[model samples]
Target: MEKSRGMLPRLFFFVSRPVRGTRGPARSTHVGAAGAFMSGGAGKRTAGPGRQGSRSALASVRAGAARVELERDDEMNCETRDSGVVAAGRAMTVLLDPGTGGAEANYPTRPITLVLGAAPGSGADILARALLPDIAAEVGQRLAIDYQPGASGNIGAARVARARPDGHTVLLSTRSASLHKVMYPYMDYDFARDLKPIAMVATMPIVVVMGNHVAANDMLDAMELARFNPGRYVCASVGVGTTNHVLCEILQASAGMRMQHIPYQSSAAALNDVVAGLVDFLFTPLSAALPHIKSRRVCAVAVTSQLRIDEIPDVPTIEEIGFSEAGADDWYALMAPTGTAPRIVARLNRALNAVLANRDVRQRLARLGYMAPG
Candidate 1:
């Protein structure tokens, strides 16, 4: 005699029956049964096959319960937590499919809102626009990007933090995610505390440019400009607490270099002063400094990255010049307020990665100084 695999479903169904002197009809069917199944009456049972069916029935019930418990939280994936088998029916894959909630096919029910902390003309805002188009297409809903600039994005971040947990709203910001705790220690909500990590965005490198006349003849020469000159050297930055400010502080603390930290109202003002040698040094991103470097207005002394930057291969890195740790830069990434459904996160990750794969989107982002990808 041979056993039929078709009988497995029957066996699984029979296993759910109780064997304690239980009796019931064999055929049972229910419509729209996702986890719970239709079964015959529970009555008298025998000690042989009836007992086995009853045990299998109990196993099925436990399986469904375990599946729900494993993926309903902030953990990475189903495999990490629930010892639950990796299958569509049992596992939770958020951000991978918009119509994941028991739909016949993954489809989004509403538009998604991506909130950014930068101003309208800022680099972050531009990057958001560049990335949003393709992603919005994939998810089948128009993406509405809302920029909330005050408090460096605290206002908009707070909005998402309090939004519904159904994954409609997202937060996009730079490395400031981690520093937000430090930047606004007294704020009502903390970044990492209130938001969940989605995916890391591209990293923008900062360049170390210098004036022609101030070329450090030697290490002693550079140190002289840093230490001996002291307050005579004024450092200009687009604003306080940006990568520029961090780099300026690192240099001051590491080499005993002292300079006046002047916060500019805008990047243009700081660039102009640096070009005219009105400011001793200015810390800016490659995108902002590229124009000055090409126009012979500013010199790129070194790139902040640990290696030589491809855009400006002629420039050296800070580490190469015996400065072991005086480099600082910014990296951007996607985040959602805590408690957003994991399924939604997985869906968004898939959509965003698909958009990034497009050749035109990739090239345009590179042109924007994101270095291809981070």
Candidate 2:
């Protein structure tokens, strides 16, 4: 495993947290505020907002190190923005304007770094790497993987936050990875505030499962219990700021119920405890839950996708029961530091999209429960 890259010189930017729902990628970053967490108050702070803007926001590992700062736009290297717009808390679907040449020609003159926020065996990590070679071909540069998985992807994200704006450094993250904003109040970084959404590689669904103890027949049955019991029950999340937690939040809001939360860094940990009757239920990736669901070790409660899944078509959707939450196929998008040249971002998006469109590549990703972007 790669040890931390130590402290990066701090480089801050004008972080913006767009409250709008995701349209098509690109939005501002957020610096979450501080919180006390489980013991008493809110959890960690968001990474951006509450953040003081400067080009150099680096936090050196050992401290007392001089920091590196970034300069405001030089005006000479400016590029146009994607046309996607934000409407009333929702993001608009937008596409990149294909670049003809210039940057594309010089792209990848050096080895490129692909920063993965999820763990090694995670679906997000799998999807990003599947497209890596194809992406490298497009840029004519050797691409590389710089895995920085930790603190619910925040550690890796923070690394990206301080990377050179030159676009050589790219972060691999997903919607589930992006849920840290509202879930934790003490996060030090925000997806919308620190990174630029380059392209959405693929999206998978989030599923809800019950522990051995639930004893409920279906979602409605459990709903009745949760409604009656309120805070008596609990839900499990992979981490503090994960879609698992967000799904729980959405469920609570819609069902008019409250289920306390228990957080773990990985699904394996949460699933093990949940199965052992240590924790309660969890809303996690289908990729991780399939094994348990097949063995009947855990109960499949609801799916968060818009439609049914081929693997488990009959599973009820959160919507069928009269609510919609963050259950859309969870997606992983490639992001570069904000201020990364628009040219480079477009080049990477195009190359990666090309890979997603490949037949063989599609099949490989399918096995991982990843569906390429249209």
Candidate lDDT scores, in order, read 0.54, 0.58
Error of 2 at 124 (Å): 2.0
Error of 1 at 367 (Å): 3.2
Q: What TM-scores do the predictions have?
A: 0.64, 0.67
| Ten contiguous residues minimizing lDDT sum, candidate 2 | 33-42
Best candidate, lDDT:
2
Can you write out model 1's per-residue Cα lDDT over 214-274, one digit (the tens) per residue?
6674333554665655455566654555555555554444455555666554455667777
- Model 2 has an lDDT value of 0.58
Q: Cα RMSD for candidate 2? A: 14.0
* C-alpha lDDT of residue 83 in model 1: 18
Tens-place lDDT digits, model 2, residues 158-185 = 7887888788888876554444444444
